[model samples]
Target: MSTTVEKIKNIEDEMAKTQKNKATSFHLGQLKAKLAKLKRELLAGPTGSGGGSGGAGFDVARTGVASVGFIGFPSVGKSTLLNKLTGTHSEAADYEFTTLTTVPGVIMYKGAKIQMLDLPGIIEGAKDGKGRGKQVIAVARTCNLIFIVLDVNKPLAHKRIIEKELEGFGIRINKAPPNIVFKKKEKGGVNITNTVPLTHLDNDEIRAVMGEYRITSADIAFRCDATVDDLIDILEAPSRRYIPVVYVLNKIDSISIEELDILSRIPNAVPISSENNWNLDELLEVMWQKLNLVRVYTKPKGRLPDYEQPVVLRSSGCTVEDFCNQIHKSLVEDFKVAVVYGQSVKHQPQQVGLSHVLMDEDVITILKR
Candidate 1:
């Protein structure tokens, strides 16, 4: 029996040979959908493995408001950088694959306890179960932020390989989910609406994805110029995660100043010498910015707002209702109204309800019924 990886390879080979045109669009869409399903199956693990975590023996207890996972080829100073950033000793050495498990650490920055994970090094074919790469990447998918560590001495093409590994596992780095809204109906026979002209996909391609998923009745609305893969992603949304990634260029001290200047131009990259602890502060700043956390301060009815400790919330989950729920589940039930004072509201502090969206650094006072 061919393994899931083998099956995926065969499909990829077929896709490479198939040319893309009007005649082949439907076939290409079918192939892409099949490839997505196969990859999900591969990530789901083999039969009877009893799926729990990504892989056995490395899933650690999660902590802090957000987690950052490190991924790189062997010996790219991931452990050294982790130790320097978090003061947690994760066996650092000059050899490859020195750290074999998920090493967890915590660093308090800007009143937020951020968890940092030092994952094992992955090779070229890591996505296909090479040297615990699948497990490492799996752990990384759950993290709020990912630091792709790279050795300055190595070829920059290594970055693309790591990206491909993550992409094959359905991890979209530094990307937002496609603006395609999907809904299922009991009797509708595949209705599609688009606000903007789709340059990359047509109704036939979208229908091909929906047909492959056996979704005979549904409504899909495309808001952006999305491709067939984007439509398939929405159909297989459970298997995908839109994650933020920061490229950490390690060991800058090994290269000359001219070489360093060239490496700095890479987008979303932070050049640092992990061994020498250079530019560590900037990395933390970039990390905090990418995390996009909202820190809401609670102000008592007649007292000043508490700035020392904050009720930190993810930007996506920082609504007034979410804030109340975070404080206490029953608080929302007993709430009369919430008075907000900050940039979220205009002019003055206004009375808002549970549905009000809270912004970062917003101050709020809840009045009970």
Candidate 2:
């Protein structure tokens, strides 16, 4: 796969060199994005391993490497948020439609990696092929989560306009609802009560609003399971082609305490100040929890070996002896016994036959002597 990708890149580079006049900056950018996406797919595993199939599918085995899609209306601080999250320093401007294309970056969170993609802003009538909304939605379908950024200053009706557009595209993302982030000046500290109106409501009203959105206190507990299966059920339906979603409330530094309080009432709505760089770590932690990833380590005991080295094997109740056979016919022929080291003391360093059932992350030392 690496060779194929390299060859494709070489071909593109050669074409760019030969057809200088034909290749535009936009074309080059598209090529670069394709190359990057391909590299990511290869690292994640075979394509369509997650849920969906074809170009719209995601890689499930690579759920530990989460990807969040930043989506919202024009000038909703999507680009700024991406820059803040990944430190990519992408171009950010105050004008509408500053980002004409989708940009991707990697953000490291607590030793885990998450990919953040800044998608093109959506406009009204996007579902019917208006503006760049359709293209943006296509890009978003490839992500594991979507952070719908909304300006709190806008009226409720205007906010609904964005939601309508998303719904028009037949994208059913209920897990991570659109986060209402109030973007304003950076002078005053984030005042939840003053800046966010939702904070002014009593706990009962807050719960009511969450209930209307299908978000309840139980959802928080449900999210704690920290497994891909849980995340999948939360974001996408039981269908074979659904991805997870996460809500992010960005630009909290601009809001008043009262308004911020109201915003805080929403479940799983993260507050972040892109300008001041506040709560980014907390946001990442929330995303990690939402991903529900399980870590498995493999120590080679020697050199790390190449990238293609297989540390884990997919099996069907095969024993250690069978695994040795799979690794090489000669290893099975010379297989004497297997030493296991894990679980209780009785099982520690125990020499067992090839029929031993391997538990998750069990350390097995095969003996040929």
Candidate 3:
């Protein structure tokens, strides 16, 4: 029996050879679905390897309100940057693969504790279980932000390779979930409704992808011009994570001014020299923006809001209830109402209930019943 990787390659080869048209749409869709499933299996750990997410030694205790993982090819200054940023040492060296395991550190920025992880170097085929790449990327998946460290002297194409490896492992960097809604029913046949014109995919291809997942009865709605792969991604929603990523182009000191200018133009990329500590502050600023954390200041009953120590929450779950729960387990149940003052509220110091959404720099004082 061929291995998962081999099977995937065969499907890919077939896909490359098969032309996309009305006649081959179904075949191509099936190939894409099969390719995606096989890739998932490969990332789940090649057949009989016990299918673990990562190595025992690589899993470190996550700290702070947010975490950032450093991933790159060998000797890309990940350790040096981590040491400089967080004042923690991780045994940096000139040779490749100097860092063998995950090194954890912390940085307190603007009163928010952010965890930094220095991971080992990963080579090509890392997604295929080559040289701890999967383990390194597995750590990255849990990070609130990812720093794709690259040596300024190396080929720029390395960025694309690293991104491909991450994507193969189901990490969608700086991407939102597709605007496709799906529901399954007992007996209704697969019905696809499109609010917009279906430009990237047609009904035949959609049906083919749905068929691969063995979905006979479902209601599918598309609000965007999504491709067949996007539909497959929605089907594989449990395995997908849409996370933010910031590309850290390391070793800028080795390059000239012109090169630095060109590097700076890349979207979502920040260039810095970990060795000289150049542009690190800018990198941190970009990281802060990408994390999108909301800080809520607690105001005592009759006093002012606490500015020294504010509760940091992710923007995705920032709400009055989430704020109370972050404070104490019973704060929500003991809550009668909350007085809020900030951009999240319209009036000054308005009384809001548990479900009220909170925003950054919002001041809140709770009254218990």
Candidate 4:
């Protein structure tokens, strides 16, 4: 075990010499800590027959991988949407309780692999441990984003029941609320009508109106380009959290062109037909843009550097120095300067300072010495 630890450290050192990336250093530290923990466990030895309850210790799951979970009432096309997004057929049906277990699938979007989990549908009394709602809630806690699917055809009462169940589950939903996807619409068309106060309508009424349009209450639009400040006004007037909510007016194949145009006009409303495979790509692109992601490519030297692969960073209008700091703390500390190359200019190395803002496709080499 000690030899193995030494070997790991040597490998990390070699990597540090070759590539100056912050993520690599952080990962190396994690590896060292894990190795230390294993050594300690081994040294402790034979606690109730050399392994304890299960007879063998298992590794805890590592976090930090971004994941999204599908959550909503039963029979809201959660499974169908998951299949469409991830191409992992997780059994879709028209009836309630079709999804008995949590299904996980991965979809590649904007050059990143995103894990999407389809959790069991939430029902009434879920928070109080009725209808196995607690189990569903447990599955949701791991997700970075929740896709709250709502049945437009279902009664508003049922929709309220589901929302209450979610509140009862006590999941720390983001300030940016989960995206809403409406399902199961008839052939005619759904109307926007008006963006009413959530407090004015009971759950049943909300469900009725949304069902007519095949959307969730969250999908209703407010003018255009509604910023966070504008959302705060909407939420305060009605007294709700100001979270960014996107509406997907799904089942477009069944709707009319005029209705589709109406949906397009609605702020952040995307019309998609997952069954006929329409507008899914556009929907994904829109989601990515809303998430505010910027792509940075790591040069493909002889061998693809595992730790230094292309990274997607949260865009904040920062310069190349900011990017370097995000990549690794050591690189920032030892930062002498950087040389720019590739894409925008010829491979002629241009010396740059820490304040140099990077453009897309600007290949950079750091001179750590």
Candidate 5:
């Protein structure tokens, strides 16, 4: 176990010392592929004694429509945020290592129940199997959103370190999957195509990465300008998760208005004071948007729409049929058509088929044959 980690560290050290250029592109690509494989193995736990987190993962039986994981160093007020947002009790203190395991909470926002988990504190070398970092980040990989809680007094380096930790674990925060497409072929040799000129990737780099992965035959198409890292991410897509993240700058009451204004300038950042309960509403609003959850009201025939508990659905697969499936699996079998009376419809009450995609807050009334 220690030897694998040592190999990873050595490869990373070599990668850092080597400069990137036309001459070193192939070597760098190989090193990156090697590093990725070693890290994957470390997490896989070949010992079969439960790798990464040791026993079982800290993951709970997930509830609610979406889950948000809170990750930060100890005493960054993550537990406080979890308590305030979810009204679930999580032991909070000014000291480090206060929150040991995953403490779950539930946030009722905009008719959607979002689960929030206060994960164990993360250290600088957590990604490299330092501390309980693997366990903490393993749970984070399953979250729909992540709250990277930061102390207002902490240096910007803390934020960078946490980001690197997540990056190493194949968590791409606040990013979409790369536009590059990869396809496997049996007979044809590797064929590459790019619609746009790639500035950060060369032929050698691409070939080197694929070769290291033992991908001898594949069709590669790049829709946008891509880099070697982007190609690597594409290849590591199975292990990767593209999740939305919000930088939660806590203890904002200790900072002045001038400092608050400057902190707010950071992209996708929300400043809040969990103790003082300052700016929590704004934080919730931002969380709702980032979650991208759709709140759909189910209106029974000849009755008002039930606005209390919406049939919440994710934005990616929120069609009339999907909505019906959420209510009951048999609803689809008994389906005829749907009457949508919201942003998804043209008239006050327009009849839509099961394939019609629903927008947020859309009122849906399914009719059975």
Candidate 6:
């Protein structure tokens, strides 16, 4: 039996040689699904692995609410940025692979304790279990946000290569999951339906992917103009993560004015000189927006709202109950209405229940029963 990497290469080679057209749609879809499964198996296998958070010395006590991971080719100023921004020093050097483990740091940005990780620099073919790249990428997968730190002087293709590596490890950077509802049932017989016209996918391709996974019964509802890859992503949802990424173009002080202008044009990219601490404010601002964090102020009974330290919550689940639970586990069980005052509520100081969602800078006073 060939190694998993060799098997993956074979499938990829076959896929590359196969012509993509309506005549070969089913074959291509099946091949794609097989390729996806092989990659997933490769990541899950014990090939010098890091069990998610990180392996061995690389793991750190996860501090803060959300984590931001630094990933890129070696010596891209990840350590320098981590040290400068958070005042926590990681090893920095002139040579490559200076940082060998995950250096954890924290910064209080907009009242949210955002954890920043200076991860070990990953080389090309990282996803194929090369060196300690597997563990590095595994840590990155768990991050809420990833910073693709790149040397401004390096070739732009570096960005593409990093993206490809992350994608291979089932990290969907800066992309949302497909708006397709896919559910597996015992005897539904693979029903496929669509709300909008799908220009990139057909029933044949969908059936082929499902067949490759041995999924005989499923209900797939497509709400967007999805592609075959989107279908595969939905099928491989367990391993996939939809993460937001910001391309950090480092060493901009060495680049020309025109070159800096060009690098700024890249969407979701921030160009800065980490050594000189230039344009870092903009980077943090952009990071704040991408984080989508909400700050809720606590207004004690018959007292003014506390602005010194607001309770931080992510927009994904920023409910009154979540706020209560964050402060104290027993607070939610009191079962009282919460008085709120902020943009989230329609009126000033409106009374809401535990289920009411909180917003940024919202003032809340939990009234006991």
What TM-score quantifies how close candidate 1 is to the native fold?
0.94
RMSD of each: 2.0, 21.0, 1.6, 22.4, 1.9, 1.5
What residue pairs clash in candidate 6, if any at all?
none
What value does the lDDT take at residue 126 in candidate 2?
A: 64
Model 4 Cα shift for residue 267 (angstroms): 4.9
TM-score of each: 0.94, 0.50, 0.96, 0.51, 0.95, 0.97
- 249-294 in candidate 2: lDDT tens per residue? 6667677989988977766677777777888788777776665542
Candidate 1 per-residue C-alpha lDDT over 96-215 given as tens digits, one digit per residue, 9 for 90 to 100: 889989999999988888899999998888777777877888888889999999988774898999999998878898889999899999996988889999999977777677788888
lDDT for 142 in candidate 2 is: 68
Model 6, 201-311: lDDT tens per residue? Answer: 888899899889999998889999999999999888888999999999999999899999988999999999999999999999999888888998999999999998989
lDDT of 3 by residue, 31-125 (tens): 89989888888877645342345687798987899999999998888999999999998999999878999999999998899999999999999
lDDT to native, each model: 0.88, 0.55, 0.88, 0.54, 0.88, 0.89
lDDT value, candidate 1, whole model? 0.88
Candidate 5 lDDT over residue span 46-105, tens digit each: 664223342354858789999999999999999988888778899999899999889888
Model 5 pairs in collision: none
| lDDT score at residue 108, model 6, on the 0-100 scale | 93
Off by over 4 Å in 5: 47-57
